[model samples]
Target: MIYFDNAATTKISENVLEEMMPYLKENYGNASSIYSLGQKSRAAIENSRIKIAEILKIKPSEIYFTSSGSESDNWAIKDILNKKEKNHIISSRIEHPAVLNSLKYVESKGIDVTLLSVDEFGNVNLDELKNSINDKTGLISIMFANNEIGTVEPVYEISKIARENNILFHTDAVQAIGNVKFNLKDLDVDMMSISGHKLGAPKGIGILYIKDGTEINSFIHGGSQERDRRASTENVASIVGIARAISDASENIDENIEYTKDLRDYFLEKLLNVDGIILNGPIENRLPGNINISLKGVKPQTMVRYLDMFDICVSQGSACAAGSIEPSYVLSAIGRSEELALSMIRISLNHNNTKEECDFVFDKILRGMKKFKK
Candidate 1:
């Protein structure tokens, strides 16, 4: 099967799984236990933390592992309440549901929220963000990159704005972890969230980077794990898996970017040859492996099913929001009509994808367009 849904989740690397097997079987123990088996698990967890921290150029103490990126996003956004002085938050309209829904939850609790608008290409307007900031605006949570459109936000500039205004900044970097090149230290964002499954690890592990001195309230209570910040029994195997997966992804990122960009461009070029095919997101500054487009006369779900018939996997939009009857909010935010939004499909590539596969997908897509177009 040709898997074009890497943005939703990636196949776990064999090397990562090999490393995790020991913890899953022989070394299975609670990290919080006082025994040696538990200590082994505890040691593995810390070692993974250190490796991930070194990769982002931050202290290991600052990294906290949670269940998933959604949990991380929720924790960071909810932490705003801890700062009673800061009653307002600024985010964009194109954020993943994790952020948008969490904002809605906070809004229910009397916290003011201002959703900044994005351009047609899904780039958050820096001018609008600057104009929206006020003393009451205590937090600015924008994604590092959009999941559906693959638009890389001006996060460095946004972080700088937040710092200047003495407001905390948080970025959900789930989709940006391996695809985009940036040093977290230099970016200087106060909080960032990453998920393991997006980068080749299992789905049960995630990390929230809380910079030193960024005080936030605990997310999960009843335990002393994660330096007492996040509470849970550690998933030792998945933690180790994430460390290995991220290490490999980070080390070979440059090569991976070049390879995926080549495949993406080749596939996109071929797809654009079809009449009435519209590309979403900016041609420049987008993720190397993401290709989103709307086939003017076709429904996205129908196209997805058509592709699946040939064992080729694609998606309509975010997997988290799959099956919703409403059109893509991301596409709509970028000024797509309701019909165009419903026509959108996302083709996310990875290092494992090849030119031959792209060719096959393109051919199938053309056939699908002909078959399904209204």
Candidate 2:
């Protein structure tokens, strides 16, 4: 299968799986226990945390593990809202559903939320962000990079405004972890969220980074874990898997960027010229592996099914909301009409995807496009 839905999830690398094997076998033990077996698991989890922290240039204590990016996102927003009696927060209209839904739930509780509008390229207007801040605003959460359209936000500037105003900043970096390279230590953001599955690690593992002394409440009440920030038995194996994947990805980060960018550009150069194809997002500023397009006059779901018949995997939008009859809210937020939004599809690349795979998938998509020609 030519899997172009990598923004949904990636194939776990053998190295990551290899790192997980020991914990899944004889090393299995609760990290909270005091016995030697448990100590081993605890050590592994802490080591992985330190490794991930080192990669991001943050302190080990700042890293909190969760089941998924959604969990991290929900926890961060909820914790912040519940901690202080603050009633206002800010986020982009183009955020992942994880953030959007969490805000929706809290909005019912009398808290104020401002979903800032993005430009046609899916980038949040920094001026709007600056204008939105008020004394009641406790936090500002915006994604570092968009999943559907792949537009990287100017988060450094956002962080600056948040910091200057004494408002906390959080970014959901789920799709930016391995695909985009940056030093988190340099950014003034208070928190960031990452999902292991989006890169090379297995599912059911994610990370949240909270800067030192960031005022946040705990949503989970259980045994002491994650420095008393998150409460749950650690998934030791998945922790090691995610840590190793990040480490490996960082080692060849430049190569990954160059290779995937070349393939994505090549693919778009060929595909965009086709009649009725309209490119989404800012082509120059988008993620190297992301290619979103709208086939004017074709239903995205129809094209998705047609491409799948050839074993080429792509998607209409996020896997989290796939198959929903509603038009893509991300597309709509970026000014796409309902019909144009419904006709949009995403083609996310991966580190391992090759030119040959692109060529093969291109022909299949060409045939599918013709078959659905208006």
Candidate 3:
């Protein structure tokens, strides 16, 4: 199968799997326990935390592991809202459903939210983001890179604005972790969320980087896990796998970027000549691994089904919201019409994707278009 759905999730690497095996088998002890086996597990978890912090150039104490990106996002958003009542939230409309849904829930709780609009190229306006913040603004949550369209937001600039306004900033970097360069210290973000599956680690594990001294209330209140911020037994095996994946990805990120960019450009070049094809995001500033396009007159679901028949994998929108059949808010935020949004398909690549697979997908898309034409 030609897999082009890296944005949804990535296949875990063999190295990561190898690193996780011992934890799953003999070292399966609760991290909070005081016994030898538990101490060993706890030590491994702390070491992995340190490694992840090194990779992101942040302090190990600042990193908190979560169940997934959604949980991390929820914790960040809800903590802010709970701590400061009647505060305004600034976020882009193109954010992943995790952030968008969290903001929606916050709004339902009587918190004012400003869903900032993106330009046609899927770029958020810096001025608009700046103007959205006021004394009542508590937090600004934006995505590092768009999952569907691949457009990289000006997160550094937005974070700076948030800092100047004394509002905390958070970014959902789930799709950007392995595909883009990220330095938590360099960016003025107060918190960031990352999912392991998006970076070739096992699913159901994620990281939340909360800058030191950032005030956040507890989400899951039970035990003293995650510094009492979140209460759950740690997924030790998955955490090990995530740390391994992050380390490996960081070491080879430059090569991955170059290789994927070549494949992405080649694929786009082949499809650009096709009739009624519109690229959804900025051509240059977007992620090298992502290519979102709308095929005029063809519904995204139809194209997805056609591709699936050929053993090709792709997505119509964010996998979290796939079954809804609703037009993607990300596309809509970028000024795409409802019909165009419905017709959009995202093709995300990974280091494992080959030139041959790209060619096959191109041919399949062309054939699918011909059938649609008839």
Q: By TM-score, who's the top model here?
A: 1
Candidate whose lDDT is highest: 1
Estimated TM-score for each candidate: 0.99, 0.98, 0.98
lDDT of 1 by residue, 242-331 (tens): 999989999999999999998899999999989989999999899999999999999888999999999999988899988877899999
Candidate 2 error regions (>4 Å): 83-85
In terms of lDDT, the poorest run of 10 residues in model 3 is 78-87
Candidate 3, residues 1-374, lDDT tens digits: the string is 88999989989899999999999999999999999999889999999999999988899999999999999999999875675543788888888888888988988988989988889988888988887777788888989998889999888888878877888899999888988987888986899999999988988999899999998888888999988888999999999999999999999999999999999999999998899888998999889889999998887888899999999999987788787678888888888998888888889998899999998999999989888843
lDDT for 224 (candidate 3): 91
Better of 2 and 3 by lDDT: 2
Residue ranges of candidate 1 with Cα displaced over 4 Å: none
Candidate 2: tens digits of C-alpha lDDT, residues 1-374: 88999999999999999899999999999989999999999999999989988998999988899999999899888765574566799999999999999999888777799999999999899999999988889889999999999999999999999989998899999988888889788986898999999888999999888899987777788977988878889999999999999999899899999899999999999998898888988988889999999888888888999988888899899898899989989998988888778888899997789989889988887887888867
Greater-lDDT candidate between 1 and 2: 1
- The alpha-carbon lDDT assigned to residue 276 of candidate 2 equals 85
Report each candidate's C-alpha RMSD, comma-separated, in the order given.
Answer: 0.7, 1.0, 1.2
For candidate 2, what is the TM-score?
0.98
Question: Which candidate, 1 or 2, has the higher TM-score?
Answer: 1
For each candidate, what is the lDDT?
A: 0.93, 0.90, 0.89
